[model samples]
Target: MEIIPKLDDRLKDSLYIQLYRYFKHEIEQFTFETGMRLPSIRYLADRLNVSNTTVQMAYQQLLAEGYIESRARSGYFIAELDSDFIESTVTPCTKLSSEDSSEQKEKHILYDFFMSDIDTDHFPLASWRKYANKLLNSEHKDVLKYGEYQGELGLRKALSDYLHRSRGVHCTPEQVVIASGTQSILHILYQLIRWKNKRLAMEDPGYQGVRRSLQGQDIKLVPIPVEKDGLSIREFKKVQADAVYITPSHQYPLGMVMPIAKRIQLLAWANEQESWIIEDDYDGEFRYRGKPIPSLQGIDEHSRVIYIGTFSKSLMPAIRVSYMVLPPALLETYKHLEWGQTASRLHQQTLTLFIENGEWEQHIRKMRTLYKKKQAVLLETIKSVMGEHVHVSGQNAGLHIVLHVKSNCPADTLIACAEKAGIKVYGTSSYLNQNKTSCSLPILLGFGGLSLNDIKQGIKLLHKAWLPYYKSSEQCSVTP
Candidate 1:
């Protein structure tokens, strides 16, 4: 109950205020915590070397403020804690959002498999630290103020340079609008184009996160199936979608690089249909083989394509600096919508340093090397363990790949088996629409974060878990 009040700087008038502040800080810092009784007025006075009146006045002030509350007979205590406060502060991951009770409702545990996580182990912490310090120590006022909605000029310029040299994306900094990520940028796009009928054509088994971003928006999505060739452009001729979203460089779920012909075909179709194309160029920087295919935006002579790039896949997902190379036609719309309302310069400054100082390239080179090795090891393990029982696809460029399960077992069953083994794998049914149940059971597996040794062990666990199904298949094959 001893409240030590340091009253060295306190006088008569300000003493009460000072005392209140000191105690308030103590309560917050856990010197006096929730449900803990504070010292009486007499004890506080003796400890702080202040008068009884000053201590009493401060206590009264504390009670008046929301920092503390008086328990009528016993004394004052901190107010009852909010039961849901701890859970409320959980960090926003891809699925977790700020909403009503609906947000916390128990979704099926399979929801975890559907999650694509950034491999934190591979993040360039040293470079990030250098850039963060550079941003914070800079003398720029815009870094601290409400910054350009288009994003910091330096960052936009840096990104422009990067897109040109690395990914072959075409456009100046003015056409680029920095958003939190592709998801946030898509939201802005959703807002800008809501007046149109807004039927979006998305790739079948495409990036589900994109679909989720357009959730509850005015847009309607038409799912187009992906094939060995790439996004089935022939199918787009049937659907009357105004906008088509794609992962051109590395097609999602099936990792086939869209050849120059397909890319040209898609652009031509979009032009004829007057449809906009969103080229989500995620993980394009980590090419394991061959010369970098030019971006759809780079080849986009008609200005029908929007190029989206992110540091999330290369850097960690938490570093939300994704930019888009807009066509000239959309520049005014982007400027009008984002000006005085969106993006912060601090984020721009931070990412700008990462890009301009050559650290971004160095980091990308290192991760690309590491991820390539991981992919090789994962493939080796899968081949050795799972063998011809499953089919693998889309491990060519991105961090994740998909495996199609045999007709002997369903995808949900395999997913359930994986969870039981403490290994997570996603079933492709979620990516597919209503017709998913009849299709081959595709399991989306992320191998980027796992080490070669972990990948080996994980495959071992997976094989052991699937032994029952393997045995049943073997027994059924016997001529009994």
Candidate 2:
């Protein structure tokens, strides 16, 4: 076979190195199939107008790397490689057909029920922008500089006061550590706790982000089943875990609120075992039925609970601000690490001013009333449209609820069908651990981002999409 190597002189790479790369790229791209003999080094040197020595060096390097084999008198041949491994290493570039591309573009999402969305329309943008500008223009210029390694003291103080009054959490500004997001906070916590214990227990069908963070830290995870009340204390007791991460006020996806009795039991378990509890209050601000449930950290007397709160859901995801209330013991260790600030100082300063001015509280109040009505609209629409084909739960708090479908079809099929109809819904199977127990097909539907009219229309579309699989029955009653 006649072949030539392209070598660039200006690249600073040696001619032999360039030649080696060319051959390797060809082999990887399957231009030179396995067992295909390469051109004789002397002949290739003459063809490319290069010295035979350069070709020999390049061929020797390829041979050493196992990309080529030199047989006695037969010259060089391409080596047989694992096709799957080769494909994985080298991504082939190809263009999609215009028909297929246009089809993808045409799939416009008219309605999206994303699980972690909040009403962007009601965000206090004007007030926030004013405060942010004021902070940026301050004489100190501190907002432009790194505030604190732990976090800006002003933000922590405001958060401490707010959490104490609203969620019943007990903490001072010193105990607070600002983080970029929940995962960042979890990563820090994993670093601190892994020394004490590597086995961490998490709720089955829990938040996947937490699971991923723990797994990324190389910590062993024990899945504890979640019951109607909350985390099954019975199952939790059976395992020996260093710490348990839970969403007590409103369990993720499932929406089961951990009752006072269960919360007390959980604290007792932590106290007896000396195991730590991490309480994530992601959306504790939007309770519709009664007074908000007191935080697990507030009720803990033994200081076993580490409370985490975020403004992402209540305010906006782009804010990228979350805080962790560490126990005194952990705080001491965390201070020693001295991990410099992870969140933006400007955002923290602006948030501090907003919270201190009570503007944050006012915003929460407004969002709560608005979200409560949206939740009611969603539940009412599900009842009127979906009827007895499905059951719903996890309302009364948070921006999303769980819709339990009675059909035998997997959750993904329903989600795909909804997608075809320009509606978006999420499934819970991905959140489940390897040992998930519940057989019910559950999908999460969020109402926070959608208008009341959109919620009704989307539910009607979903009803039409799923009507075929649903068993005929009287309307299923659902309440928030």
The C-alpha lDDT values of all candidates are: 0.72, 0.83
lDDT of 2: 0.83
Write candidate 1's Cα lDDT for 219-257 as tens digits.
Answer: 778899888868888897688788888997888767788
Error of 2 at 427 (Å): 0.2
Candidate 2 lDDT over residue span 1-480, tens digit each: 536556877778999998998788666645465899888988898888888999999999999988999899898999986644454543322233464345434767878999888898898889999998998787986567778998889999999989999989999999999999999999889777754447888898889989777665567888898999889988988887888999988898699898999999989988998989999999998888765679999999999999998989888889899999999989878977778788999988889899999999999999999999999999999999887788888886889999988755567666765665568899888888873323255889999999999999888877765654453353233321
| Cα misplacement distance, residue 301 of candidate 1 (Å) | 1.3
Question: How does residue 118 of candidate 1 score in lDDT?
Answer: 55
Per-prediction TM-score to the true structure, in the order listed: 0.72, 0.76
The best candidate by TM-score is 2
Worst 10 residues of 2 by lDDT: 471-480
What lDDT score is found at residue 275 in candidate 2? Answer: 82
